[model samples]
Target: MSQTSTAFRGVERLVAGQQTADGAGVRLTRVLTQNLQRRLDPFLMLDAFRNENPDDYIGGFPDHPHRGFETITYMLAGRMRHHDSAGNQGLLGPGGMQWMVAGSGLIHSELPEQESGLMEGFQLWLNLPAADKMMAPNYRDVPSAAIPEYTSASGVHVRVIAGESHGTVGAVQRPVTEPLYLDIHLLAGSRFEQAIPAGHNAFAYVYRGRAEIAGTAVDDRQMAILANDGAAGVVIEAPVDSRLILVAGHPLDEPIAQYGPFVMNTAEQIEQTLRDYRDGKFEAAVVQAL
Candidate 1:
């Protein structure tokens, strides 16, 4: 187990979310900043999506390009297969994850593997610093069976996706951002506590049931940004069986220029990315896994 910091941030504010459609009409709730306020900084955006109606999700996300950031997809139900510009392809099932570094640029598509009985997942965007923005693109895909899990005496199951939890390190091959991403499930009336990086900005998204974070009742699909006040970690109370995703990352603290699928340091850089995509750089890059 990672040592808990002496002081940790508590729930500061609740961020309301809205639904938005992107990538060939994949409808999802958009969380985090909608404008360029950059309130979330290194953690750009989080999308919480769940649909049982086949028509609601069967379309999936089609080919899309990304740059100057990383995209992480965690599946809780159903299956998705991805194909990228570099000829890399893989399938993600329940409890699986895919972390893609669209460093310079990359093109990819996530499509449902079947007609779809139920589909639920999240796609998180974590920004890269200006220094690492234009690096080479890479992909890391981890299956459900491969992720590290820990069960507590209270029946809280924690999936360490990209951080240390319960004495187990996450499976995510995260390097640049070195962020912590954890999926936590708490049984009814269970409690959860985990250490977080002292220097990183952190937030938690309650997806199911209710989480009493810092004594505030956070409902489903709600997010709480942890206060920056020095504190070791967060303590959560699950009145009912609840699920949440915790994310924390180092802030790039750089000027952000975002245009559709591109996030760069400046408008000129965004234009450059467009030019590169128009010039077919992502597709032409040599195929390899990171």
Candidate 2:
């Protein structure tokens, strides 16, 4: 075979699964997320949780302020009602996603309805480039059915969420970090492979079941970071009954200084972010600062 596959050097396996609280102490899993510090380049965090009892996730994310970033919430099951100061509101069901760009600033709240049942989902954070960090606030609420998926002949399933990879492309169009977000599942006794562009950093997060990634055995609740291949495309392997989240993006290769919901390149920027929020220097529309 010709040299066409991107081979990542070194896989930094993050620590085992951890948990954190949101929206009044509602608990959630910090799985394959929070690589924002070092490993995952431009992406900030990923939180996954499953709630059956009301107490598990009842008190949803209350009115919170955000700036210089975007939040993408994907629901696996149950309903999530959303209301934002940007005048955007909707209900996110299983397979639904709420993609909000908190440029400049915005306040939003997400609360689950009265229905009682299993509610599972993921919330991801992506940073805006320095030039676009202070842009206008916007949102993209993608319903479950609106998002497209492509299944391979080998039973490898790929859902395009924000970017494009393999032969599948997500619907949302923006100046992304040239990334590909895919949710994949491999059937029993199956082997799957997908190609990734060269020079992009790639990682695999095993969400459910066990699978072999990059020739390394990664079971549930673990993440494998692959080294950049520069110009050669990369491929991933998935064993039977394995579910994986494959994400690859061009590294910003820039300095990152983060504080709560604001991420900038310098300490002065972080301080200015707080000042703007407190003094109404950045508030647009009737946005709340909670």
Candidate 3:
């Protein structure tokens, strides 16, 4: 097969997240939220939690309700014990990821497995279109061993979680918005590029080291939201060894209304979700999956 060069998607802006506490005092960095920036369409929020102190992260996230979107939890270090209204329970450890489809609604809890050593992870919220908002809830949890990894000749490594790269496809399938999620690492002087869908929104969040994104320098814990006015790819060159997460997805282009953990396309839907949740829709929602 002929190789296509990844094009230049201009950098739209550079931004950084802030420290915030959510869900029973679990501290995290809130990078993207509905109120923080303009509509990112298919995506809603991205939270990065990295803590070594027991007091900082021991609280964990207690039972919470969600609807109208999907929640993706990826662990880079430590362990998170998960239990939900749907009878799903498991231990999400280092390198594992859980994708929760909160179409309609579900209640779940995530707690630290131990007092603490270090807990590092990311939780991404992807919006669902009006059509799929009321669909049945589900989940897809992939272990580290099941995820696909690729290493280049120049020492650029990638973990493909929900897209295709280097002829290898990720384990996630049937996404409504057709998203691309990758954890990338680059050695100093190494360059990496990847194709993106035309007209789709794309962004890169650098959490470690520094890199030049589309000719713009981005430091750790910062983000570069690409403009759709340019080419259809993201290009990166690491002046120093770096690690980052790259995400892009087709926009739903629909109205969005969010309240706490509940997200919907309309305030009426949000109200309905609240009513259903309060009325016990997810009260007995445990469905075992092995």
Candidate 4:
């Protein structure tokens, strides 16, 4: 039998992300900033971008370097082309996703494939354990149809992106973090529940419409941090049609040192990463990984 959640988690706090521009002046909202890294262990940052104007995202992301972490990009609309130093290339379309692990290091670019129209998506940074920080780099492109999804009897639709949901496994899984990423759509007056492991840290980000968690209203574009108050799981209800992404992961509880795309366990490691990039070592690392 599927374990059910009797005690539901409540909203500890709500976050209204800061407006920020990145990647050649592409505007976006930085949802999970650096301050929350320790609190939301194993997760570094979350950036949400939804732009209709060409000027807002025309430049897209130019050549960039990253190391010691993973980036998960989910596209809701529009197209983006990805090219990396490791000779990995892919086109991410609507409802598609790109999961890139910048283990040792990698230089990559994500530029828009279209001139106009809505371009909505999210980029989540998941931390890597110290043991796997220097492992081989990896990348995977997952199309919309490839993701596992299901609809509950209560009219709640769920797309499992990175972990198991109600026995439906996601497209990708990491043993160390055991991250859970779910995109859920709820009809008016519908309710949904999922049993979350007690030890994992969890939160819900509402992207469309409004929803309720433990009687607290979570409006659109808001993120609700779930309290670890001995709740078995999370219970979400929609008074009206709504969409949200639920993310949970095991806490690494390790030291986090980050310096613009480089995340390491120690400041010395970060300094070494900077020096490596200056010496054009990222390309070599990518070639070695390949």
1-290 per-residue lDDT for model 4 (tens digits): 24477788999999999999999999999999999998888899999999999999999999999999999999999999999997778999998999889998989999999999999999999999999999888888999999999999887999999998899999999988999999999999999888888878888999999999989999999999999787778989999999999999999999999999999999999999999999999987553321
Best by TM-score: 4
Q: Which residue runs of candidate 3 sit more than 4 Å off their true CA positions?
A: 1-3, 36-38, 286-290
TM-scores vs. true structure, each candidate: 0.94, 0.89, 0.95, 0.97
lDDT of each: 0.83, 0.73, 0.84, 0.92
Q: What's the distance in Å from true for residue 24, model 3? A: 1.7
Residue 101's lDDT in candidate 4? 91
Q: Name model 1 segments beyond 4 Å from true.
A: 1-8
Query: In candidate 1, what residue range of length 10 has the lowest lDDT sum?
Result: 1-10
Candidate 4: 10-residue stretch with minimal lDDT: 281-290
Ranking of candidates on lDDT, top first: 4, 3, 1, 2
Tens-digit per-residue lDDT, 115-218, candidate 3: 85989989999888889888778887788999999898778999998877777787685466888899999999999888887787888889899989878999
Better of 2 and 3 by TM-score: 3
Better of 2 and 3 by lDDT: 3
Model 4 Cα shift for residue 259 (angstroms): 0.5
| lDDT, residue 67, candidate 4 | 94
Worst 10 residues of 3 by lDDT: 1-10
